[model samples]
Target: VESLGRDGLAMAKSLNMGNIFIRKKDSNSLVPNCEKHGVKAFSIEAGRALKLDYDYADKMVDGLLNFLRKVGILEGDEETIESQSVYTTKEIVPAPISGFFKPNATLGEKVKKKQRICQVTPFFKSRPKSVSAPVDGKLIYLRSEEVVSEGDSVAHIIR
Candidate 1:
């Protein structure tokens, strides 16, 4: 169990997944494999470990479509992903002032620079002050139910 190599780790050896979905299965191998009387084939590359850009997502979709087409699992369009907003990571929005944040806008929302996207409470208090975007981009994530100690990522700008 502990001596398995990184590539040799098993996720699920089954004929079917049966409505169960497992994320981050590669990190823990034996935990994902359960039950008896079924085939055991591990899909090593099931998900991503880090944030993905539009290009990466497109490539992944294309690869999956091709694989499914080859195996006769899917018969449809060749999978065309059109990204409405594709921005480079170089255009990021940094925290102006660190504090307990409460996001006002949702992810993928187009925001302009200097527009209020979230607010920060000095000590998790009521009536928080707003934090504006430094660059025009889509908000990716907001620190959900987390305690940020200052300059710790309140929201992401994807311009």
Candidate 2:
């Protein structure tokens, strides 16, 4: 198994490794072979293979329990961690079009489904395009306001 960067995929294809799991964010639903030609393709979280935090063993066990519960390997109280939340990297929102993104909400704000989250406008233009939360979540970040191209990450919503 190798890291799934651009060069890594090129190398994997050259060697004919039938199954490759690219990082979820790197995949494109548009490419048909990206799904069909590979024997298997998926993504795994970063902390799945390592300790989430070295200081707290209890937190580690709780994290493992969360995974087991997710995969149906173990079952118990559905709300074991009432305050805990987990999010994938894909939850990070990117600009749909090249523009200047201005967030109306601050980070860590609890947002409901369909609530306005941010606004974006083309560079040097006046009118803004409002971006909304697709699901209930908390705003985790607002990437700085330098410049964002189409598909460039502008914020993250942790649901």
Candidate 3:
């Protein structure tokens, strides 16, 4: 059965969208259940939580239409791109200590293992906690809020 939660990277490459694989294993979720049941399902996180970006919406619509065409479910041409980025290896780097997070890596930036991605300064006067990359990958997401608590997700990396 196709992992729709589709072969995520495949759909992204076909539609030329920002290809990010959501890693959620050993958890209760519908996507995985669909896979087990042989139901071809797909999941996509379109814009931010509340706000809507019309341009992004339009792009996604176009991609969906093109995907239909590419699969022969619809007529006409497909606008498949030459090469698209597929970010896999999902890693959520958590804050080691409760403090304010100061990021050293920007989103979409490539980082190496052991590289300082951010530092959390404690509320009390003391040395800040050094947050380093656990693996060599691209920095995909970083928390916007500076105030962080222990074990909070500070960064997301994908290889």
Q: How many clashes in each structure?
A: 3, 0, 3
The Cα local distance difference test for each model comes to 0.52, 0.58, 0.78
Question: For every model shown, what is its TM-score relative to the native structure?
Answer: 0.47, 0.44, 0.75
Which predicted model would earn the best lDDT?
3
**Whole-model lDDT, model 2:** 0.58
RMSD of every prediction: 11.9, 12.7, 3.5
In the range 22-119, model 1's lDDT, one tens digit per residue, is 33344346544631335433342322345556775665566655545544588863332322232335244445555666777886687888898877
Candidate 3: pairs in clash: 3-6, 4-41, 5-41
List, residue by residue over 56-158, the lDDT tens digit for candidate 2: 4554455556545554677763233333333433266778777877777886688887788787888777888887777787676676665678888777776
Regions more than 4 Å wrong, model 2 = 1-90
- Candidate 3 lDDT (Cα, whole model)? 0.78
Better lDDT candidate (1, 3): 3
Off by over 4 Å in 1: 1-63, 66-77, 82-84, 90-98, 124-127
Measured with C-alpha atoms, the lDDT of residue 56 in candidate 1 is 50
- Arrange candidates by lDDT, descending: 3, 2, 1
TM-score of model 2 relative to the true fold?
0.44
